[model samples]
Structures are given as C-alpha cells and as structure tokens.
Target: MTLIPKSHPRAKSLLIREKLVSGFDNGLVAKEGLLAQGRGEAFDYLLGEKTNQAAKRAIKAAAAQLLQAQKPVISVNGNVAALCPKEIIRLSKQIKAKLEVNLFYTNEKRKQAIIKTLKKNGVKEILGTNSANSTKLPGIDSARRIVDKDGIFAADVVVVPLEDGDRTMALRNAGKTVITFDLNPLSRTSQTANITIVDNVTRAIELLISESKKLTKRNEKSLEKIISDFDNKKNLTENVIQIKNNLTRRARVA
Candidate 1:
C-alpha cells in the first residue's frame, strides 16, 4: 500500500499545483502568481524536488546577512506571499525585519487581498500599500519597479524571494544588499543577488528562518564574516555543476 497517494512524481506535481489554486481562491495568491507557480513547478520537477548542497550554504549565508542587517526588509511578492505567507511572517518576527508587499503586477484589490492574507496569517503591520511615496527601480518597466518610500527604498538589506531579474539588478545597483531564493543558478536574479539560494523558495525560506534563529545569538562580526566569505560566483558555478550531475544521473537511471 502507498503511504502517500501522490508519492509518484506526476501525482505529487499535480498536488503542488492544487495547493497554488487553493491559495488563489483564498486570495493568498494573485492570478499572475498562479501562472508563475506553474512554471516553477515544472522546473522543480526537473531537479527532483530536492535542495542541493550549494543551496544549503547559500541559505545559511542569507540568514547571516539578515541577522546582521540594521534595516532589513522582506519583499513579499505574489508568489512568495502565496507559497509561504505564515513562514514569511514568522521570519519577519524572528529577524525583526519589515514585511513589505512588492509585486510586479500591482492593483488595488490584489494588494488588499495580499494584506488581508498576511493579516490572516497573523501579521499586524504590512507595508507597501502607500504608493503616494513611490521610488522607481531603474530599468524595470513593470509595476515591480515601484517600491514604497519607506519600505524597500530605505532598507539596508532586502530579501527578495523568487524575484525577477531586472528588479534584482536594479536593487543591487542602488547599493542595497539583496538576498534571493531562485531555483536556477543561471537566472539573473540568482546571479545578481548578494547571496542566492538556488533552492525551492518554500524550503529555502524555512531554512533561512531556522538559520536566522540560531544566528541571532551570534555577533555582527561573525555574521558579517559569513557574508564576506561567501562567493556568489563560485556558489553559482557549483550549483550549475550539481544540475549537470543530476541530469546525467537521471538519464542513466532512465
């Protein structure tokens, strides 16, 4: 007898999609986010739904950066908010970071829905609703370019999970330390980030929160050392090698 009915790859993938649909119905995820999740699911299926070793190191580094941040802000887009709203809130509380709702596709109702969803997840204060004080991220033409005045604008460190390329690049250019959770090592978001965890956002976020909790007791010197020691290029290369190795093994098994 099967312990988990969706244990098979095909079935399990479908189940993940179902959860996104559930999030969508509950106003936790936007329509564009639903489509983005579908694309991410396809990529996850290819990587065997496992977090690689390099990604693990990256997660720890990301946590260190968060712990050291004097003014850290977690950028909550549709995909991240839907996938791990509660976890995001927990992380914010843990690191004492601000939770800001920043989306590529923005609208009044969707922003309200996201805020409502976050509140339902027990978040008391959510930022990014006031577009009256807006700042633009250069080179990104979408609504994602628009950041709240007091949110991402003033942050020393920003955690942008599952982000698009242009925003990541723009943020980096503006001199803010960026931490990203992108699956593909080759993606611009991963490459541009100060620290990139090339793992599933859900898994990476939880690990980041866990690491941050332990790192909270550590001093700024230690945390900064973690960031200083990290080499994004080297890590990205290792992730690429891991992907190649996994593909080869999968082909052999087939």
Candidate 2:
C-alpha cells in the first residue's frame, strides 16, 4: 500500500497504473495486464469509482452460490494475482473454496511467477502445472482450458476475477456455476457469468468476502433462493444504464 498523493482527478487512477507497473517489475503481473488495467480504469472512471446496487446484489448472490457449492474454486489469473492475492486467498478460505491458476498467456515462467506471488501472499495449496493430474473443460481450447483434476474441473462453482471471455463461456457450457468481477459491464466475461460483479477487484473482492461471512449462518434453501433469483442480464443492463447516466452527468458538468 504505497501512499500515493491524490492531488489531481486522475490521481487515484495514476496510482492504480503505478501499482500495475510495480507488479510487472516484481514479476507478478503480465505485460498485457498493464493494458487491461488501463482499459478497466476507463470503465471505473465512468462509473465514478463506486459499486452500483446491481453489483452489490450480484456479489450477495455470488456468496450464496459459493456457499451452496459442492466444490467451490476461485480461478486465478496474472491480473487477479497481481491486484488482490491476499484478498483472493481470504475469500477462498472464508467460503471454504479452492484456488486454481488459469492464465490466458499460457507461459510456464509467468505461471511460476504468479504461483510464487500467491505463495508469498500465504497460499499453501495451488493447483496448476500438473498435467498428470489435470483435466480440460469440454470444448475449450485455450490456456484456460487445462484445469487441475481437483481444481476448477471438479468444482461445481468457480469465481473468476478479471476473467476472459472464451473461458467463462466454456465454464458455463461445461455446466459449472460461474461468478466473475469485470469492470466492463458489457464484456463477454460479464455476459457469460451467472453472477457478474461489475466493479474493481480491489473493492469487489473485499465486499464479497464480507458478504460471504454474513451469509454463512443462513440455511441452504435461503442461500439457494439468493442464487436462483439472480438475473445476470438484467444486472448488466442496469449497470450499463448507470454508466451511461454517469457519463451524461459528466458531460453536462463539463
């Protein structure tokens, strides 16, 4: 947590960029992740750096779904590992879930680097790089296709933060319940997820963990109700409207 001074409107955004650059230098974030951060930041800026009501509902539903899962797994990528490794670990432990690494880059070195970073953040049991004990998502032909036997492959629920489009589709097509955090409400990843939280990972992960703790004492039927009542398309549509409204307000202010 560097204390970057926020003197300008873009100050916080610049701080985010600096953090991503630092992650890259630390061998924790991929080069493309830097670009992804910038793209997400644009959306975040439009959304006024706050989580919307729809996203909050989605996070609540996500927690309930994870609680009801037989095997809940959190899908980790370089961007997610760089942004919120400790928070990811905390959410996984809070919901009694597994952590599995799934990268779009498909690099052995980057995979090891992400694993090392997660280990640095107190992750003990990581599931990646063991093809002997691996399985693939049916119809998926990407770096994310190869999941560990005991990881996403076996899990009934998966939380994919900073997810990719094709893999999210593959996971749903494989009949796995998918929850995702994508800053862009219109992304294919957001559209494909059963519950999509359209917020920054830093903010959304902590909220999700908090929500999970509160919902743990509830009954299974109640939890299933929360999951069953979620509407991803409607949620996404509302967020899109929110973003548009924000932009319209900004235009008027300017």
Candidate 3:
C-alpha cells in the first residue's frame, strides 16, 4: 500500500485505489473489478462522496430487512472481498447472515483468494466455492448465477454490494429480497434492488452494521414496519434528484 497523507484531498479515494491494486496483485481482484470501481467512483464524486439522507433511509431499511429475515446471506465478490472484507465479515456476524462468495468472473484461483482474504479477517464459514452444491439462479446468464444451495439458494434476503443488474433481477424472481450498495441510482443494479443504498459501499457498510445492531432490539413487528414503509423506486428517484441538486450547486459556484 502506498503511504497516503491524511491531509491529501483525495486521501481516502487514493487508499481505496491502492487496496484494489494490492488485491489485483494478490489475485483477489480481477482486472474488470478495477474498471467497475472507477465507474462507481465517478458517481460517488457526483454525490459529494458522502452518505446522504436517502442512503441513510435505505440503510435503515436494509438493516431491518436483514434482521427480519429468517435466512439472510451476504454475497461476496472479488471487489467486495478486496475493499472491505473485515466490514463484510462483521456485518454478516452482526446479522447472523451467511457469507457466500459469488463472482461474475468466476475462477477457482480468484475464489480461493477471496476466501483467503475473508478468512484473514475472521470469517468462519463461506459458501459458493464448492461446485457440488452450487445451483443456477434463473433469469441470468452470467457466472453470478451459480449460488450455494444452502446459502443464497435458501436465503430470504441477500446483501449484494456492488452487484450486477441481471443477478439482481434473478434474485427477485427467486423470491428473495435484495439489498444492494450502488453509487449510480440509474444503474440497473440500483433500480432493481429492493433496498438500494445509493452511496459508496465502503462508507455505507459500517453504517449498515451499526443500524443492524440497533434494529436488533426492536420487535419483529417494528422491523417489518420499517421494511414495509420503504419504497425502492421512490428512494432511487430521491437519489437522482440529489445528484441533480448537487450538479446545480456546482454550476452556481462556477
């Protein structure tokens, strides 16, 4: 990792880039993952690189949904494994959700590398690595369709950070509630998710863990109410409006 001064304006972004570079070098992140991160970063810049009110609302809903779910699973890919393995492990443990490794660019070596990263961060068990128990998700042709029978296959709710649109739709078709972290509100993954946190995953994930902890004390009815009140389409519209407002503010300054 490069030594980035905290005083640097782009220190956090620089650090994230370094992590991905390290991940790729270590065989944990695919080359495509680097490109995806850049795309998300562009949207993050548009949103001012902070967690907004709409994202907070979606986070709260996601936490509630996770708590209420009988079987919740956090789907991990190379980018998620590289960027926030520790946080992902913590959130999975916090909600008692199973952790599953699913990738669009599937390969045995990269899967093992991701599993290794998670294990280093104190993950006990990970699914979706074994082909024997793997099952295909309907409505998607991507490699992400392969899911563990006991993990994503049986899960009622799934947390997919930095997900693709096709799998998001497929999961919904499979009768699962999908919670996703996406910076671009207009993206297919964002629009298709049941609860879309239109914010940077690195930032929103910690908040999701915290919110999950708080929501655990609430009764089942309370948790259900939170999920019911949330409207994903409306939430996405709010995020788009936020971006427009941000652009307008920036134009005024110019």
Candidate 4:
C-alpha cells in the first residue's frame, strides 16, 4: 500500500502556486522554482531539500553563535513552518532562542494558523505577532516582522531558515549575526548570512540540534571561537572554486 497518496489535483496545485509566488516575492527564486517543484513531484522531491558537509559546518557555527548570544531568535516563514517545524522548535529549545513567526504574506489569520500548527507540534513561546520589518535589501520590497518585539531589535544573533536576501542583508546591517539555510549557493541570502548552510532546512536543522548539544557540553570560549571562525566571504569563495574545479574535472573526463 502506498503510504502517501500519489496526488490531489486542487491541493497539489494550490501548494505549488503558493510556493512559486512566495519564492518570487522573496527574490531567491524566479519562475524556475515552480518548474522545479513540478519536476520534484514526479520523484517526491522538494526545494532546498539536500544537506552536505558545508551545511553541517554552517549549522554548527550557527548553533554556537546563537548559544553565545544574550538574546537570539529563530525567524520562521511559511515554507520553514511546513518543512521543519519540529526541528525548528527543537533548535530553539536547545539554545534558548525565541521562536518568531515572520512571513511575506503578512496576514493575521495565516500567521495564527502557522502558530497553531507549531504549538500542536510542541513549540512554545512563538513571537512576531507583528509583521516583519521592511528592509532595504534588494528583491524584498516590503516590511516583515521580527519575533522578539523587544529582543529582535536587540538580538546578537538571529537564525533565519529559508530566508530572503533583502532581510538577511538588513539584519546584518543592523549588526546582528545572521544565520540562514539556502539551497542555491548563488542566492543573496546565502551570501549575506554570516553562516549560510547550503542545505535543506530539515537536514541542516537536525545537524544544528546535534551541534548545539555538543557545544553545550563544552566551555563558552570554545563555542565563541567556533562562531568567530565562520567567514562568509571565504566560504563563498571556496564554494565557487570547488564548483569550477568540479566542472573542469567533468570536462576532462568527458
């Protein structure tokens, strides 16, 4: 027996359209995100759905940073809520980070629905009743909410999963350390995040939980060192070089 139904015409299409529009509005995706979802459905695939070594390291760094912060917040969007709500809640608990529901849609009913889902899964203390603050980052042209009505503005670190580049940039400009998960290495969110995990939100979150547990057993200095060592520019440069080398190797083999 099939564990999950093959398809639902209305449900599937509505889901697809929501993701496509959200991605477009957020700026990390173009029309292509929709196309990819269509293809992914054939094989049970999802966008930003894979994790790797780089992602693990980034998660570790992110965990360390959040744990070290006086105040840290985990910013959640709709896709993140659907994809890894449990993991998100787990990480927030591990690091004592506040959970904030921030979305591009900016609808109270939708936000409450997402919070209800999170609460059902045991997430506590959800914040960001207000919409996200608008930033000057490219592509994101509107305001979005920050979870900690008081703390988000003062947080030293903010973990944002599946985020848009503009908000990521804006958060960084505000002097808060930004951590994010993005599948595409070339996206602005990846480049702007202090620690960008190039992996699926689910896997990356799992690794972050593991890393937080490990770090919690260590001294604070060690944890600080780990966060300090994460250099976004260097990491991006390294990823580019690796990709080019891989392409060159493939050409040679061909």
Return the clash pairs for model 1, or none: none
Ranking by TM-score: 3, 2, 1, 4
Off by over 4 Å in 3: none
lDDT of 1: 0.82
TM-score of each: 0.91, 0.95, 0.98, 0.75
* Model number with the top lDDT: 3
Better of 3 and 4 by TM-score: 3
- The C-alpha lDDT values of all candidates are 0.82, 0.88, 0.94, 0.68
Model 4 residue runs over 4 Å out of place are 1-50, 130-141, 145-148, 245-254
Candidate 3, residues 1-254: lDDT per residue as tens digits?
A: 88999999999999999999999999999999999999999999999999999999999999999998899999999999889999999999999999999999989999999999999889878998778999989888988988999999999999999999999999999999999999999999998889999999999999999999999899999998999999999999999999999999999999
User: Is candidate 1 or 2 superior in lDDT?
Assistant: 2
Residues 168-199, candidate 1: write the lDDT tens digits. 98899888999988777788888899998888
lDDT of 2: 0.88
Name the regions of candidate 1 deviating beyond 4 angstroms.
Answer: 1-13
10 residues in a row with least lDDT, candidate 4: 40-49
Say which prediction, candidate 2 or candidate 3, comes out ahead on lDDT: 3
